[model samples]
Target: MGDDLPPDLARLRVLETWAAHYLTRIRARIAAVERQQAQQQTPAPTAAPPSRPGTGPGRARTPDWGLAEAGIGVPTTEIHRGDCWARGKTLVPVSAERARAELADGTQPCAVCRPDRVLNRLGSS
Candidate 1:
């Protein structure tokens, strides 16, 4: 009885050695796969300049002439009369008094807002 270690213990030792070897191989395989994946998936950085100050993600990349026109406070009729003004042809917002004055001066109400000329005045067709 003193010399008898169970057959299961002998088998357990063999399994432990095999499991250790298997785990080592698996770890090596995982490391190799990770390295290969990293090499394959890595993206090269671009050479474009960084965004300017005050700019944010999702900001329009193209020029926005509407904001530019609004910045100068140009009259809508002068900017958009012939479609020559492009995107900035929409009218800048005005106060109620200014709108009344414009209406009194024979300026036609915008088609979109026949009754409420003040709202959505800047949106172009």
Candidate 2:
């Protein structure tokens, strides 16, 4: 094939190959540029509120000390088994189910232990 072509024509074939390779490279570059532009135009996620300091993994929110609206204190002792509040008035070790129900009904936790603090805080208007 080389023998069939003049030196100038052989040089032109090499230039053509170079141009093809350059075009492919340019196409890939353009695709990458398009992807970057698309990403820049898209919106980012909104940041969440920062959490409070000094709270531990098992530690929950502070429960309200106020009496239940029913005028009867939910047996807090059932929740915190060993812990009692203010001269046996409150109890710890609430059952998960009861807690959930109370929470669903907008009940709060014992102010002393605060096991139901999360529900109370959420339920409060």
TM-score leader? 1
Measured by lDDT, the strongest candidate is 2
Q: How much RMSD separates candidate 2 from the native structure? A: 29.6
lDDT of 2 at 106: 58
Q: Write the per-residue lDDT of candidate 1 for residues 15-122, one digit (tens) a residue.
A: 666765565466567767877997898666869775653256874333221121322222334212211122232445455445455556655453322423332354
- For candidate 2, the lDDT comes to 0.48
> lDDT per model, in order?
0.43, 0.48
Q: Could you give candidate 2's per-residue lDDT for residues 1-89 as a string of tens digits? A: 76755579688767666765565466567767877997889656659654443245786533322233321223332233123232133
lDDT of 1 at 37: 91
- Backbone N/Cα/C clashes per model: 0, 11
The TM-score values for the models, in the order shown, are 0.30, 0.29
Clashing pairs in 1: none
